[model samples]
Target: MIVQDQANDFPVGPEDTSASQATQDQLHKSYRMPDEQARDPALHIAKDWVQKKKLPDMSNITDPQLRRYATLYPKLRLTSDGTLFLEEGTGDDQRLRLCVPAALIAEVIRCLHQHPLAGHLGRYRTYLQAKRRFYWPNMHKHISCAVEGCTTCRQSKERKATKQVPLGQTSTKEHTRFAKFYCDLVGPWPNARGPGTKKYLLTLQDAVTKYPEAWAITDATAENIIRVLTNEFFPRYGVGMTIVSDQGRQFISTLFQHAVKRLGVFTVKTQAYEPKTNPVERLHRTLENVIRCSMENEKVHPTQWH
Candidate 1:
């Protein structure tokens, strides 16, 4: 794997045309010629360095071992056209890979990341594209940095959005069943009962068992909602200590507030736009699916959805 040529052990020999052709074929499978000379800034630096037959001095390298390698290694070999490169691998696996200059690292990354034929790819794919024909110190780090900074690549990829802060304890201190209920309004569904008869849906779910209760109401007004809660919900599930609902006008109305307060019930309202905080909102999707599928089948009519 270490394809270096020193005075002893591994010595640099005359170039083999057949072996070189094979390497070229392998490289050709992945490598595409850059569109213009200026596009890959590393190539320009390499060309200039080769033309001058000189490399930047690394005499100030703090590590003695690294200073020695820096002083001796790069000058040991070059490509046929005199471009600076590191000879890697051994025997049949040997390859002459481009030695990228630090100044051109960003440019090289841009070229590889946006390579017309192979650009706009993921981090690993972009890294492999560059790896096929180039070498540099911390090459992977640079490639990863480039991919992370690439707006096109980042925007094109589909990724899930995760909440940074965890929702600690979701429910109230009360541990009793039906102690807390999450309430929300589903929608103004398409005219299910003739025209505008049963347009809105009121969804209620228990915080403990996740058992859901829903009612189809003509409107989302306070009177209509309190009727369902008092007659249908409270009678069936029994009144709980707390009612959690979103900040809808109906939930905050004086009539509904007085109605719950008369029952010795506490009302907790979730912040606007924070749908996840309201557990009943999660059930709306399943409720909608059930309603839609049932309406489609001949056995169930939309008016009978309630």
Candidate 2:
């Protein structure tokens, strides 16, 4: 099939009419190949001239041709660029302006018509309708996808606002305000290397200041705990307003109570089975964590618990 070049390629050589048969009357004006031009990338990428022509009147155009055009230019799918019509913007919407240029629209039409997926245009058309339908609604509303032939963001990217929870438990009001303090014994952790060789930890924490006093023991009897608590720690830190402790037999025993009553130091005990009555228990949890983490690098320190 012979291809017809653009009608306005050059002033169609004024129809030559005077040549005789013997003079070999040229059938058409001689068309010369254009002189080669250098390839300028920028020239190819330049935007097309502004739209000026009236939109085409394809009133008699068959659905088959429209379908074919849609294949070449998806948005304006045309079988060939030459077959394109100048499009007009409707009001200020210029919705079609968001689409590719008439040239590309023409190519989209061309591809669509000839594409093996031509039968699937109805689905695509539904999507195109959606893009136009949802994007910029109610004047300022918006919805669109950034992919080829996508109506709803190409099946859309599912994004969820990340609900990040703060990392650790937050503190509430301070449990006490002055020099009141807390103390407790944490362990007689069974010896890993041998039994009957007991190891235990003692924690003494200030209730008001929240500072800690720590000690380690070979055993956790009431006598041993009170002896060291009164003689050693109190002298240095001064008698606290109060001491809160777990319900160990030592803190409840007569000997331990007598020592506190004589010294005028008040004693508070955590309710049986409730460790939190002693806020120092929280610090104990931290110390336990420290021990656990250090265990990976070194064996649990038995005597250095303080």
Name the best candidate (by lDDT): 1
What does candidate 2 score in Cα RMSD to the true structure?
A: 28.9
List candidate 2 segments past 4 Å from native.
1-178, 192-198, 299-306
The per-prediction tally of clashing pairs is 0, 31
Candidate 2 residue lDDT tens string, 50-130:
122123334643454333333323233111222122122445543221222222233333222223222112234423432
Kindly list the per-residue Cα lDDT of model 1 for residues 6-76, writing each as its tens digit.
Answer: 33221323343332223333333534332222244545544455456666666544554344335546543
C-alpha RMSD by candidate, in order = 19.2, 28.9
